[model samples]
Target: MAATGLTPSKAGPSRPSAPREAAPAPPGGAFARALRRNLTAHAFLIGAVLCFAVFSWYPMVREFFLAFQTTENGEVSWVGLDNLATVFNDPAFWQAWRNTLLFTVLALLLGFAVPFLVAIVINEFHHAQGYLRLLVYLPVMLPPVASVLLFQYLYDPGYGLLNELLRLLHLPEQQWLQDPDLSMLSIVVASTWMNMGGATLIYLAALQGIPGELYEAAELDGAGLLRKIWHVTIPQTRLVLSLMLLMQVIATMQVFVEPFLLTGGAGPEGSTTTVVYLIYQYAFNFNDYGAAAALGLLLLVLLAGFSAAYVRLSRAQDE
Candidate 1:
């Protein structure tokens, strides 16, 4: 007998599976078992959704239904577009609409552009960035009442600090808050001061995220500062800018508090009568919930159009 270089094997040539990749080890002790409990997770998620439906969606749907219904003495009745007809027919509605448009446009020009430019400037400056940020954000921490009251004093017709400063610098002492023509402008200025801080912070974050290398390369290729910003920074963060613009338009379109607090709902000659103020008047002063809800729906439709446009733009960019 002779021993050969062979080993014992099962019949049929010992076929075996190519090394079975280790089964992803079942997650591990208690944590793994808990995670696999889909019933618990699904139950919790459905409960959360139901809560939202009850609290948010139900209220919104109710508002929609009420928009087409009339109420008298705390009782509601179906009116079928009478509220819409009334809203369109009312003279005040046009005025409110005009004021809302004006506020939105002015705010974008005065508020949005300033913060964006300031963000760009701050991103460039090596010194005072933190100091300037803190200084700008300080207004945000101030209560709106305190801030408005402070502005009232500053815009006072007599012995105001700003008037004195204007006097000292040889600038005309304009009646800021009192004049009907100047009242909306005054509110815009105040709101801009308060609102610009957060916007500036968002833009600054976006600006900082832009790679310095892009600018360096652009400069190396003889591109100037404006060109670099136009070509590089603008394109790089256009999404954030568009998002902020939409938000600012929506927010500024609903300007109410500043005008209400500053000018007592409507300024001299109804100059600062914004849409939101009008809605508040309908809902509270006149007890016309239907009209208020109708106006709200109008705003929702307009802003929804803007949001839909944004979604399309985002999707186009992704593609």
Candidate 2:
């Protein structure tokens, strides 16, 4: 080997002087890395992807498309905003929206309050906590059809347990299901029994996570139970409460089964025709898929707005 002034042995042309620094990865490269990691980390993602693709993405896309088109003799033709305009012009839309809101408000008033109160009290009670939790969740485990059918007897206008109880107490028997005014209210009550159980258990579980020291500190500060609840309990459980409120906004918007089974799909004089029920009537009763899809899209938008607002508020609080 001839070595003079450290001449390099030419296995190849001396490598070009290296760049001073390496180029940074493109923005999308990070995403690709994350995708690979997540895919390699879990096998469940494949099944989840397939399920979401088939059920959620496919239906949502088709529904949006269907909203703009009507099927005639197995051919689809665009009707533009006609479906939406028709839905808006229909008197039933407003009626259904009103009924849906009323049901949600009534449910929030009775359903949210009673369950929260019960959960807090139950959580505080020392004895048989597990047993009490199980008891409260029993209604949630019951079959929906069974629950609705049982309420049918309870809501019977005549010769029902509710009316008999009223009579025993010298109270006039009011029309529970047959009267327009009371029909929604009756369904709300029956549904509250089913709904409250799940929410109450959720509250109970949330309450368990809250530090007992907070309550103890509040107690030391001469805080009464209500004051402590206002200062400590409510604040501590605020997230859970907001989550439940959002859930109620979503679930109550889609009120169907109770009204469907109890009030014969429409309440007395069409009082309980919720937006979802209206969709059902349009799709199944009149075979108006376009109108149904339009109405459904509108409902989805409204619910999404509510959810977004709640999420923003919640994030602000966390910050």
Candidate 3:
């Protein structure tokens, strides 16, 4: 028998394998990821800042400097308060203010009230709401110049649709844009027609947001339409109304286009001459940029003060 050399050897302990090391991260990887994530937002912000700097901030700074400086033949010199003094002393200054105030009042009466009323009326109708909204907003979509021109034709004393309607109804045909007494009113009417669409839509949105349960509760309380509106609707939309009122006042005070196109920047007997029109006159017609800037500074100050006060009051009310 062959003895097999198969003696079992004593087994030694096996060595453990070495642990693998992770790959190192790329340099600045976190920073690159963050930059890429916000790149679009940063781009939009930068563009907005640049636009404001160029068109708003730069112009404002230039206007402030120009207000205190005068230009003569090509040379510029500081004039302290002379430009402001000149603006104050101008004969047309008070008249322009008076006209602007009047326009503001008239615009508020028509522009503010009409849109709210229109919104209310439209909101009451459940059917054809889209059609009504589109019809109301059509004028807003039109070019401002075209709308003004259309109104201009409608205001012509002869051969105008409005006057023709008056004739048909045996009413006196009015000189809508020619007569001093009626010129401002006519302008207000046209402005209301052209601009009320936006306000109406805003009011409509606010109205729609009001809870239907409130109206139902009012109805249960034996409230009529007017009572329901006064109690439920008005209270619900008060904030919107306040905001729109402030905006309306600011916008009306700065009105230029309506009066400008309607009455050639000044109505009969300078009736429709607004502060903005006066500013235009100073800068362009009379070539008095200093006075224009001074006047603009005054307006800016006034509007800023008014806005600040309004915001403070609103905050107080909220509190």
Candidate 4:
């Protein structure tokens, strides 16, 4: 070679020209890869999306439309706020609201608290825990209708087992489901018994996830049981508690079966007639689909608010 400045010295092979810049990734190929990934993702989601659209979203949209429209003699027509006006004007409307609110409050008091307490107690136990869990969950597996009917029999003022037990204790037999003041309470008690199992189980799982070191630390600091629970347990389980609170509120707000089957939906002067039951009456009893849909929309709004609160609380918890 001509002894040119090209003495094969130091820098090795010039890095092969940087591998030709990867051929610019063939824009179409990159797009195709992304498209394929997105299609696969969407394919996995399509079933659930369709299910939600068909069952939940579609019904919600239909309910919205029905709220503003009327169908009489198979003729559907837009009636603006007439349906809402009818729902607002009905005397039972406010009563239903009041009853629903009361039920939600009572359900929180009983349904929310009892399960948490039961879960705490069960979590503390060292023996027969599984059996107790099964016992607690048994009522949940029962058919709701059967459970309601059973409670109805137990609530019978004249011949019910509950009254008989009261009589045995030398207490006066009182009307349970028949008394307007007690009817809602009675229904709530029945509902709590039937539904508390699921909440209790959830609480149990949450409790199990709580590190024992927290409790030990509290105990080492001379914190008593109640103090440990307040400072440690409650704080640790706040997210679950808040979530359960919202769920119980939403569920009790829509209560229909317990009151309906126990006290015939109206419940001794509509004492137990919830908004859902009112909607049922409007739809099936009066054959007023528009009014029913309007009332249902109102309930849906309320539930949606609760759901939003739940989602916010959940996000906060995750953070």
Candidate 5:
């Protein structure tokens, strides 16, 4: 055979391609990946923490210090327990506490019960629920001062709506805020009107969350409306009720705006004076920040103890 110009090609053993390096894993492995993934969430959380520290925590810390310290002629000095003694010896101290307790009782009677009743009634209706909710929440959206002033108008003895209604009903119109006997009650009524909206809505939400089957079972057991509420509704929403009761007590104990606006903080014969109002008098009217802070510390301790006890009781009940 004639020799060809190209020789037959020989196939050598195949060489494997170099394994690709895994792009060096970016950097700090899993931790870096997680940081990048949650960076936005961490940013928001940090902002919230900073805000709480600046506003809430800082004031509490400052209040604690101010409770034990006094300032005179621009000089600050530690006055261990003197402020507390001053508050204790003040005649208004016991009276203020009494009035505050009275207010809380009155508030619980009206503010606590009324909202739940209102919620129950509103929930019973099959129509106009949205309108009812809006109506209930309308007062909440109004400026609190405006609401208080409106109630003041309604409470006026001479030309107030309440007195006019009394006249129409052939009843003698009595002094509402001016009389010491009726002053606290009047304040409580006004406070309830102004603040019940939020609580009513919360109650409505809780009521709606209840399972309908429970009510059906109650009905099958021949339970009346009251019975159903007692057996089914109350039990189902007990947690919410307890929580709201505690919050109501806390809030009512700290009340200031309504009485301050309605009856000038002390009312007739100091009948409407409250602990918070006394604190205000100490701090602003009397320029005794130390005494005010001391009173505030006492209130804080009381509320803290109450809250702890309440939580313990709730846990016991749950268990």
Candidate 6:
């Protein structure tokens, strides 16, 4: 062999140097490409952004401006807290708040709790689940006005189905929408019937997602039905429950249509009058937009706080 240090070793003919493959271009290179991508994404979002701006943001901003301004003979002038003062000074303000509070309490007791309970019961059924679900949800599919009008007729004191049933059961006749003491409760029942389906469906979905093993473990520990629900069902579904509670509070606080259509907006002795109905009266009946906006602003603040709490709770659950 020639001197090993001086000669190249030959295993075979040296393979021709392999051509280097070019690296794939960075997905849209960093700067201009990223800008282009952002522009495209924003372009796709533009329609939704514009819709929210026009319908949601603009209305909210306009309401805030309108709340402090007054129009006299078509001339608008800023009046600061005068509009707010007018709302505060209205004789119906406290009564409206009181009635609204009562409606909210009744709605929570009936509307919020009943749906969750119904959902729980439905979750335990082994047969005809679909039929039951349809039965529960069918009312939600009906037009709201039609449902309200139907409930209004059903609540009539004389010659109504409810009274007929009561009579058959030997129960005393109820004035329903006509009775100051019973009107709000009657509206709560109607509103609950019309609205509970959505909440029930949501609760049902949440309940289904809960691990069956949890209930098995509870039962293995000798937990009874109520104890199993308290330990397993409620704990597992607490997040959904809390969210629904906040939503119900916000919704019930702003109730209007039920009372409006069922009881001529105020009911007997204004027992069913709500803050939203008061706003309606100010805006339409009195043509006092400023006062309406101011009252709406107050309601908006309260709802905003509830919404914020809901968001916080949701985020906590996610974390």
Please name the candidate that would achieve the greatest lDDT relative to the true structure: 5
Please identify which of the two predictions, 4 or 6, would achieve the higher TM-score against the true structure: 6
**Root mean square deviation (Cα) for candidate 6:** 5.7
Best by TM-score: 5
lDDT of 5 at 198: 94
Comparison by TM-score, 5 against 6, better one: 5
Question: Which has the better lDDT: candidate 3, or candidate 4?
Answer: 3
- Stretches > 4 Å off in candidate 4: 1-44, 306-319
How well does model 1 score by local distance difference test?
A: 0.87
- What's the distance in Å from true for residue 206, model 2? 1.3
Number of the candidate with higher lDDT, 3 or 6 = 3
Flag clash pairs in model 4: none
lDDT of 3 by residue, 68-130 (tens): 999999999999999999999998889898998898899999999999999999999999889
TM-score of each: 0.81, 0.86, 0.90, 0.84, 0.92, 0.86
User: What ranges in model 6 sit over 4 Å off?
Assistant: 1-41, 306-319
Write down the worst ten-residue block by lDDT for model 3.
2-11
lDDT of 2 by residue, 141-183 (tens): 9999998878888877687889989999999998998899899
Considering summed lDDT, which 10 consecutive residues are worst modelled in model 4?
17-26
What order do you get sorting by TM-score, best first?
Answer: 5, 3, 6, 2, 4, 1
Worst-scoring 10-residue span by lDDT in model 5: 4-13
| Whole-model lDDT, model 2 | 0.89
Runs of candidate 5 with Cα error greater than 4 angstroms are 1-21, 29-32
lDDT tens per residue, model 4, 131-203: 9899999999999998988897899888899999999999999899878989888988999999999999999
lDDT of 4 at 113: 92
Instruction: Candidate 3: give the clashing pairs.
Output: none
Candidate 1 residue spans exceeding 4 A from truth:
1-55, 313-319
Each candidate's lDDT (Cα)? 0.87, 0.89, 0.93, 0.89, 0.94, 0.92
